[model samples]
Target: MTDLTEHEVLVRPRAAPEAPAGRTTGWWAMVLFISTEAATFAAILASDFYLRFSAKGSWPPTSEKEPDLVLPTTATVIILVSCLPMLLGSLAAARGSRAGGLLGTLGAFAGGVAFLVLQIVDWLSEWPDSTVSKDAYGSLFYAITGLHAAHVLIGVGMLAFLLVSLAVRRAAARPRGPVSLVAMYWYFMGVVAVAVYVTVYLSATLWATR
Candidate 1:
């Protein structure tokens, strides 16, 4: 030990790992996107109310009866129920529990598919000329509900892709971020569907039914 105190080793501390970019940015982007979409639906709803109230005598114009509430109400229940599974999946992912996430995600996806099928069947059913070209009632009805249905379909596809990525474990090792964004979108879709159901089905039935 010859002058060991004077010849001390200087160890450089290891640098901390840099966080990946777009971690919170992705969530912000989705929030903005959904804001714009909500605005669009709001405008459409306003226009519908304006047209319905402005027209003289009979909001649906006598030709078109109020839409069947049973089908759409049923679909609403299904979609709303789907949110539970989606919430479960998001929670599981946050805790890094892959098996729980997988089961919940699969359940949510199946519920979404069922909703779409039921909506399509409702659209096909003959309920006193429920086509877009039929009248103002048909046009607004299709526009609002169709827009919502499209969103639901997109959400389902996103879930499918996420489910695949999670299964492989090649990427998305920590899926909390992506799963949270998807959950946000799914919940938004459900809320919009309920609004549409109220405006298109409940209101019409109460006030415009022949």
Candidate 2:
């Protein structure tokens, strides 16, 4: 056994293992998911505008008031702000800071829950007055906002699970891939929330009489 080559030993340290291909696959899957979801939303909004243009009377049928901007705007802000903490949490977890990751995850979870609550409140406030059965306007309103709300709910659930995982796992053992993936989903939700707000709420007021 003659293994005393200093140059070979020093220069040929084993290469670090490549990351699992599953992570890249998961990321591309998410991108595909977001793309499909965006197309769905675009179709819905297109239908909305088509109905708006074809209607013979004032938009929203003159009975239902245009959606309240304040609540949805607030919700949009909350969800968007939540993305910041989600991002921070992902970064913290990637950096192996357990406490910071947990805190940021918690913050993001709270914001998502708050946004969902506000969405519920807005739905309640507009109920019966602006229901799905009332008219095309109402149906579109509920369909668009409700679908977006459902997405937000799903995102909130994902964040909750991630938070729990971060809390229980050791720093080295914590799953950063999931943390980052969920953060991506959360940020997507934020973008969808803003689109929902602008399309369902702001557009109502902007083009009501057109």
Per-model CA lDDT versus the true structure: 0.84, 0.84
- List TM-score per model, in order: 0.88, 0.86
Task: TM-score for candidate 1, please give it.
Answer: 0.88
True-vs-predicted CA distance for residue 64, candidate 1, Å: 0.8
Query: Which runs in model 1 stand beyond 4 Å of their true positions?
Result: 1-13, 18-23
Per-residue alpha-carbon lDDT of model 1 for 99-164, expressed as tens digits?
667767787798889899989888888354767888788899888889989999999998898789
The TM-score obtained by model 2 is 0.86
Candidate 1: worst-modelled 10 consecutive residues by lDDT: 3-12
> lDDT (0-100) at residue 86 of candidate 2?
84
Across 69-157, the per-residue lDDT of candidate 2 in tens digits comes to 88998999998998888888889878877777788778889998999899899999899899898999999988998898898888888
Residue 124 Cα positional deviation in candidate 1, in Å, after optimal superposition: 0.8
- Alpha carbon lDDT at 59, candidate 1: 71
Off by over 4 Å in 2: 1-17, 20-23, 170-174
Worst 10 residues of 2 by lDDT: 166-175
Report the error of model 1 at residue 34, Å: 0.8
Maximum-lDDT candidate: 2
